[model samples]
Target chain A: MDLRVRELIKKIRTDKNITFLLALVAVGVFVAQIVYYVQKGEVFSLKRGFQALFLSVTLFLLFAVLQRITKTGKPFDKTIVTLLRVMAVVVIVGGVLPSCVEVFVVVIRGGIYTIDIANLDIFVPVLGVMIGIFSEIFSYGNDLQEDNDMIA
Target chain B: MAIIVRLDRMMADRKISLNELAERVGMSNVNLSNLKTGKMKGIRFETLDSICDVLDCQPGDILEHQ
Candidate 1:
């Protein structure tokens, strides 16, 4: 058909591939967590394994929705941006909640001095904040794209 | 809010259809429609030139400062 349409399709495919790579990373993190639990001979209980799995799943779902947004060719849609922001908030809160609870429990039980810094708790919060930063960048880009689209 | 495109009136005076003008201007019908309805925030100089050439009118004839 049209040259512009062909270029648009190519761009969408590229975006899909990027999202797929991100999803793959999320899966790798999930699998790595499983391996860590297995190596430690842990029972993989809900408390320990569930948080890792939840974070990875949230990341995967975020990328999936982003891919769909690119496919729909409405990147500047306000509702999509809002959904992305909400998911980022969910990821940030979910990633930090467990660690906050752990710290609270330690303080309550008079074990605050025994807090370990070698745990994975720090990484999750950073990752979640990085996702939040990306979400904000995307939100700004959406506003700019919407303005561009309004130009004749 | 100040700039207005009087394309519809010019097209009426020139007896030219939207489709014919769009083809001559080398732009899509939807884009031309948006421009005509003042929904667009800006217009390119190239498009303005093409439109003026096709309509045999000056830029001021089609654009107005309201």
Candidate 2:
């Protein structure tokens, strides 16, 4: 391999390690928030708790995906594609489930539930779908890389 | 796999070691070994040219269709 390419790969590995560490720290912070809420005997909204849990899980998955990419030294790996797809699904679910839970809670409390169109946040699920699309693109790139490797 | 690599036969006929051919062809031993064993999916024109130059043979002498 050329020295430049080796240097670039090393730089990318270092960047990924930093990102992974940051993600781990973010997960720890979220978990600590949940613990603090539990210890305070606060009536933590179930929706809020679930959102925190989902966010933490997503961050941890990001950490794992970054670690895997660093280890393989290939961003277009099949496993990374799969992990990104899973992350996309999780993000969509995380975005939508809180709203569903809010509606359920309102209905159970005997309050007339109204659709707040202005408050509906569509960006999160859209971001998830975009990630899914990117994963598909990465899958195609992985196939091309495999083909290139097979040739002399 | 209708097209087959006959690199092993060519190398044997020329009495060339894999390491020597790889060095002369400017390719790694593992890649040259893969070519010799017919494990490669395809060959680049440049690589084929180099191998031919090293072996003093034509492309047909290193490849065959069955």
Candidate 3:
């Protein structure tokens, strides 16, 4: 490969893929537990199967990528930094992607009913959840940094 | 990761122990440990001054640009 191509590949590899993957895994395991319990320990029904497959693939792919990033050691930051980045992405994507997808699927299936999408109160709650998670994760990073400083 | 902690070497050449230097510089043992281990991102001018005074050497002896 050319030098630029190699550099690009290196960057791609260094991206905090572990965080992504772990986040995926967190969401996956959470959903899996719910589904398993809901379905009486059987992952059979179409809805349960769909949930399982979606969560499993998403978690596995994302977590695997993140795990690779953590293993590279080229990023050269504290483990805390790496973990925080991973946690934030995991938390955000964990909460948003599935909900958004589900909402889109439901809306599309239901057709544009009399539900006034314009006057909807949906965005505020979602934004609040995102912000809450973001703040918690941001503080978590700071705490981790302080812990590292103490350790050092 | 290849940080060179010249503090130990300089102290050794001057026949100084870490405790003696830390006491002379009026720094806590913990902070001194951090400096000696190259865990310090920076040293204040006051700290450098104190260290230089105690070591009887210029800042150049303690810090070398890599």
Candidate 4:
């Protein structure tokens, strides 16, 4: 590999750990959000609560898998790329859809109902897409490496 | 993938076993097998050089464009 490509790979390998740590922090924040709602005597619906928990766990596991991919040194493995894509779908379903549902509920109920949107709601799924694209790039890299190895 | 590997034929003509060729070429059996079967995506010049030396054959004798 050239120096620049090697540098990029090194950067990705180092950054995955940070992504995993951020996912862990997200779990804590989600838990805290639930605790805050409870303390305020707010009606935290069971459905939304479950959704939040599921999203939190998915985020954590996605990053965990990414960390493991970097560790395995085979980011282009078809299985891992498929996993990253699957997690992207999970984020859209488990993370983004619930937020959209909350907004939809307020819309259908007319002017009396309201639900606030936090920046985190937008950020998490966007992060998921970014991670998904990163995996795709790695998958392509793997193919290139294979071609280099076999072309002697 | 379009390029073909004739390493197996060359080795066969020399009456060399896969293990013997691999041992002389300093490559593992699996990798050598991959090359022989055209499963390899690429080959290193060093490996090619070693194989050519071991089999007393030119690169053109072992690899050909399809």
* TM match of model 4 to true structure: 0.62
TM-score of chain B of 2: 0.95
Per-residue C-alpha lDDT of model 2 across residues B1-66, encoded as one tens digit per residue: 899899989989999999999999999999999988889999999999999999999999999999
Most TM-score-accurate candidate = 2
Q: Assess every candidate by TM-score.
A: 0.70, 0.84, 0.37, 0.62
lDDT ranking, best first: 2, 1, 4, 3
lDDT of 2 by residue, A1-55 (tens): 5666567677767776776676666566656766765676333355566676677
Instruction: Estimate, for each residue in B1-66, the C-alpha lDDT of model 3 and write its tens digit.
Output: 454557887889899998888888887788888888888767778988888888888888887777
Off by over 4 Å in 1: A1-44, A100-113, A117-120
Better of 2 and 3 by TM-score: 2
Flag the better candidate by DockQ, 1 or 3: 1
Clashes of 4: 9
lDDT of 4 by residue, B1-66 (tens): 678999989998999999999998887798899888888777888999999999899999998998
Instruction: Kindly indicate the candidate among 2 and 4 with the higher TM-score.
Output: 2
TM-score of chain A as modeled in candidate 3 = 0.31
**Candidate 1, residues A67-131: lDDT per residue as tens digits?**
66656666556666666666767777777775665556556656643556686566666776776
How does candidate 1 score on lDDT? Answer: 0.73
Q: Give candidate 1's error at residue A142 in angstroms.
A: 1.7
In terms of lDDT, model 3 sits at: 0.59
